[model samples]
Structures are given as C-alpha cells and as structure tokens.
Target chain A: MGQFILFLVLMTLGYLFGHYAEKKHYKSINKREKELLKLPVISCKNPIGNDTVAHVKLSYGSVVISVDYFKRILASLYNFFGGNIRSYETLLDRARREAILRLKESTTDADQIINLRIETSSIYKGNGNSIGSVEVLAYGTAIYFEKNEPT
Target chain B: MLMSNIEIIPNKTIVTGFGVVSGSTVRAKHAGRDLMAGLKNIFGGELKGYTELLEESREEAIKRMISQAEQMGANAIVNVRFSTSSVAAGAAEIYVYGTAVTVE
Candidate 1:
C-alpha cells in the first residue's frame, strides 16, 4: 500500500511538471528556430559551388533528456499494447530539434553547415528495466568563405 | 588542424593521405550525476550534467585523434566520423575517426 501511494504521487508529479517543462521548451525552440532560419543546414556531402573557402571546421551539439516517471509508465503500458508510443515521440522530437538548434548556435558566423548527421542513443536503463535517459548528438561541417558578397 | 566531415576542404587540395586515424574513450556515469538524474526523472527536464560529460569526453577523443594525426605529419583530418556504443551497463564509448592528410 505504501509503495502504491508513492508511485501514485510520483506519477502525478511527473505528469504536472513534465507537461509544464515540455510546453516551455517547445516555445523556446520554436522562437529560436524562426530566428535562425537564414542559416542553411544540409546533408550534402560537399559544398555547393566553387568558392574561396577561408576556413572549415567541425561543429557539434549534444543533449541528454530524461524521461519523466509518468511517460515511462505510459510507455510501458503502450509496450504491452504493441502500438505507437506517443509519449516518447515528442520527447525525441524535442531532443533532436534542440540538438540541431545548439549546433546552429555554435557556428553562427559560418556560411553553411553541410554533411549534417544526427545520432541518438539511450544512455541508461534504470533498475526494473525502466528507461532513464536518452542522448542526441547533431554534428556537421561549418564552412566559411573568404568574404560575404552582397547579392 | 583543419577538420571536416566532407571529403574535400573546398579550396584546399589533398597532397598526401596518411590513411585513417581513430580515438575512443569509455565513460561511466558517476554516482552523483545518477542521483541527480533520478530526481529529474520525476520533473522531466534536460540532463545538463550528462550532456557536459559527453561533450568533454568527445573533446578528449578528438584531441587524441589530432595528436595521432600530428605524429603522422598530417595537416588536416577529413571525412571525420563519430560513433557511440555502450560498452557496459552505465558506460558509453565515444569513437571518432578520420583520414589524415596534407593539404596544399
């Protein structure tokens, strides 16, 4: 009975707080994404054209996001149902976008970022086979030209 | 040294290629960070501690790769790639590799 009460309290807290945090983070991500629309991130293996390249460097961004107790339980229940786990979809979407935003933020002065790649990994699975957290890494090559010519 | 994920470095030309070089490191989560993460599991937020730990470990791996390229007398590393794997329960291994080359 005591364990059940604790679990109930934890689920309630997780639901409330997780919802709030997700809302806040989404707002921030949307605003920043619009602000950074000018910089192009592409997956092409090479630069577009023959331009005098002044510099080239590797840029990367990584983030680790933890699953709330509520979502973990929700996912486990979904697992038994064997359907889409809607709870984790938003979590992964947020992590990927946040990682890309950070990558763009790191190389603001660069002309373009090419050969972009994103990696996702589960960092830890806590006791009882419950997921603890996941990590996302976004990386690309930031290319700089000799001069920014006005078109 | 110049580093990029692409095959070519735009204006630079590859004069000599010194084959592939790689570096890897495995890191285990500390008890303190795990404890904090447990608290965060209820609140649901970013795990900044784990992020920083990953970044530092990656940086260390890159540094080691660069040193190896330096020994080979290479000025650049191109086609750089990164990979991660779980070596143990609570530990992650970050591996980085690239082809070392001299550019002109």
Candidate 2:
C-alpha cells in the first residue's frame, strides 16, 4: 500500500512538471514568432509568361513539433487505465489555423499563389530538450491571369 | 575545334534565384493529445507534423513567388518548383521557383 501511494505521487508530479514545461516552451516560441512577423518583405521574381512581378517575403519564428513514440504508449496506457486524446487533435488544429492566418495576411493577392511547399522538423538537443516547431513559407509568382485564358 | 558561334533565342521570361521569404511559426497543444499521435504513428499511421503550418507556409511562399513574378511584368510562371532547407537548427525554409515569362 505504501509503494502504491508513492507511485501515485510520483506520477502526479511528473504530469505537473511536463505540463509546466510544455507551456513554457510554447510561450517562448510565440514570442519569437511575433518578432519575426514584424520584419518587412517583398517578392521580386516573375512567373513564366507573365509581366509585372511582386516580391513577397515572409519569416517565421521557431516552433517545436514532436513525434514521440513513447508518449503515445503512455497515452494509451492512461486510456486503458481511462483518459482522452481529443485534446491533442484540438491543439494541433489550432496551431495550424493560426499559422495559416498569419501567412494569409502576409500577402496581398491570394489568387496568385501557386506551387506551394511546406516543411517541418523535430530538433533535439543533447541536454534532453526537444524543440518542435513548424515554419510555413509560401512563395509563388504573382501575376494577373486574364479571364478565360488557359494557364 | 570549338563550334562556330550560334544564335540562341531566349524565351521572354526571367527568374530570380535565391529570393528570400518568411513564414510564421504556429503552435497548438490539446492538453495531452500529441501523445496519442505519437502512438498512432508507431502503429503505422500517417504522421502529420504541423500540417496546418506546412499548408499555410506553402500558400505564403507561392504568394510571394507570384508577387515577385508580377513585379517583373511576367504574364505567367512555368516549370515552377519548390525546395526546403534548414536556415537554423529549429527553422525550416520553403522556396518556390519558376520561369517568369511574357507570352505574345
């Protein structure tokens, strides 16, 4: 009975610590993202078969994206023991939407964007700190497409 | 012997290489949902890492590319492509490229 109580206390402490750490990391990333959004940018490359080019430049702060196999196991264990996973999906969805909105506002012409690309990473430091951040950069030649003109 | 000088007709298009762009970092955490995602991936499911972030960035990059194309007075962009690289340990770059052209 004593061992069981001790284990419960340790688990609770671990959960609290993990939650605090995640919040701290998120706050820092948000601060950096704000700083990046303040910079000025322009797009200067013209697309093929079009005249008049507008340069659009965008920058993003750091984001941490983690894919932990062990975490999943723990989560499942909790569910079998009784917990929920809906919260995780909600968080990811929210992050994605916020990032998209920022990107959308950074441009003047939404119709001109083409050939888009996105990349992500999960970087780990030897000090047991893993940073997961997603940087989204959209760049395409902006041109006036004539109506009824085949692209 | 070197081949005689030959005239080459260049296409009425231009492309700017190595143009820089920016994107914003987006974060979302659902209390404790990522743990499930991690498990799902291990079970051979799709791993969507910052998908919204990637989608948004893709759009932004394309917008920037098109803006650049317009600035050059190009009618269209052809053979467009994208590439990504790490500018820093935690940051990723998405670049779009294509030939800016003016068609008659």
Candidate 3:
C-alpha cells in the first residue's frame, strides 16, 4: 500500500512539473511573436507598364495541431480508461481559428485574396499528457482591381 | 502556338509579386522527449527531432504563402520555394516564397 501511494505522489509531481514547463515555453513563444509583429510590414511592389500592383505578405505562427495518428490511439486508450476526447477537438479548432485571424490582418484588402494556400506541421514533440505542437500558416496577395475589369 | 496562363515560361516573364508566410512553435515536453530520444539513438533510433519540427513549420509557411498570393489577385503562383534557418538549437524558422502573377 505504501509503494502504491509513493507511486501516486511521484506521478502527481511529474504532471505538475510537465504542466509548468509547458506553460513557460508557451509564454516565451508568445513574447517572440509580439516582437515579430512589431517589425515593419514588408510587401512587394510589381511594376506593370503604367500600373503598379501592390502585394501583401501575412504570416501566422506557432499553432498547435492534433496528430491524427496519435490522437486515434490516444482516444481509444483514454476511452478504455474512461476519459473523453472532445477536449482534443476543441483545442485544435481554437488554434486553427486564431491562426486564420492573424493571417487576415496581414493584408489590407480581404477581397483580393486568391490562389490561397494552407500549410500545417508539428513544431514540438512532447511526452505523456503533453504531445506536440502544430503550426498553421495562411497567406495571399492584396490587389486593387479596376471596376468592371474583365479577366 | 496557344498560350495558357498556367504554363511555366522561363526567362520571358518577370515575377510581378512575391510573398512569404511562416508559423512556428516550440514546446518543452517535446524538447525533453527529444533529448532522451537523441541519447537513445546512440544505440540506434530514428532522429526525428528536427524532421518533425521542420515538416510542420514548412507546411504552415506554404499555406500562408498561397493565401498571400491569392490576396494579390494572382491567378497562379510560380517559382514556389521553401527555406529554413535555425533560429536556435531546438528552434527553427520555416519560410515559403513564391512569385504571384496575373497572367494574360
């Protein structure tokens, strides 16, 4: 009984430490992002005969995404142990929305966006309750098209 | 000869517009796990720390680049490319660049 109690205490300590460390790391990334945002916005100007087209570049960083392969295994494992998977979906959706919003701000005119592209990847790998970090980026150009202009 | 906007032409066309987008995050748990994994790899294990990080950031960056291109009223993005720089020992920057064009 004492050995089991000791194991429980140790596990609890490990969980706390893991949570604290993860939170600290997240804070640092947020700080770095703020600094990056403060930098001057850079865009490319294209010259076309008499008219010049303006291009805007927007960047979104450091979003955490769920790992499909791992999530499936985890869901089954948690279910077997009587836990829920809804939390994972909530986390993923929140990140996706936030990243999109940031991308939106990078451009002046929202209507000019075309040929959109999206990319996702893992930034960090974690253990146990802490799995990994995922990032999503969305970018496009902003242009002013003449009214009634035929393509 | 018929000309299509989607066709890739070398030297004849100039890149009218360019954009790049990137996203990155570093987590502590992963760092700890990777450190252990690296040590274990001495005996033979996959080195995935950098690979996983770069792959995720690369995808996110490319997505942002495409979105930027679309916003420029570009029908297509050509000469798309990707580059990475080590911001720190365990941290990296993934960047995607492409030429945005409105073809005739």
How would you order the candidates by TM-score, starting with the best?
A: 1, 3, 2
* Top lDDT prediction, candidate number: 1
lDDT of 2 at A87: 32
Best by DockQ: 1
Which of the numbered candidates is closest to the native, going by highest TM-score?
Answer: 1
* TM-scores for chain B, listed for all candidates: 0.96, 0.54, 0.63
User: Taking the tens digit of each residue's C-alpha lDDT, what string does model 3 give over A1-151?
Assistant: 9998865655454345434543454565466556445232223323123433333223332343433333434455776788667534544554554454455455434234333345554444454534344455444333333441323
**How well does candidate 3 score on lDDT at residue B79?**
42
CA lDDT, candidate 2, residue A60 = 31
Task: Please report the interface RMSD of model 3 to 1 decimal.
Answer: 12.2
> Against the true structure, what is every candidate's RMSD?
2.2, 13.9, 12.3
Model 1, B4-104: lDDT tens digits are 99898878899999999999899988999888888998889899888998999999999999999999999999999998877888788999999999999
**TM-scores for the candidates:** 0.95, 0.32, 0.39
Misplaced by over 4 Å in model 1 are A149-151
> Which pairs of residues collide in model 1?
none
Query: Model 1: which docking level applies?
Result: high
Q: Which stretches of candidate 2 lie over 4 Å from their true place?
A: A1-88, A109-111, A124-131, A138-141, A145-151, B1-104
Q: What's the C-alpha lDDT at position A64 in model 2?
A: 32
Among all windows of 10 consecutive residues in model 1 chain B, the one with the lowest summed lDDT is: B83-92
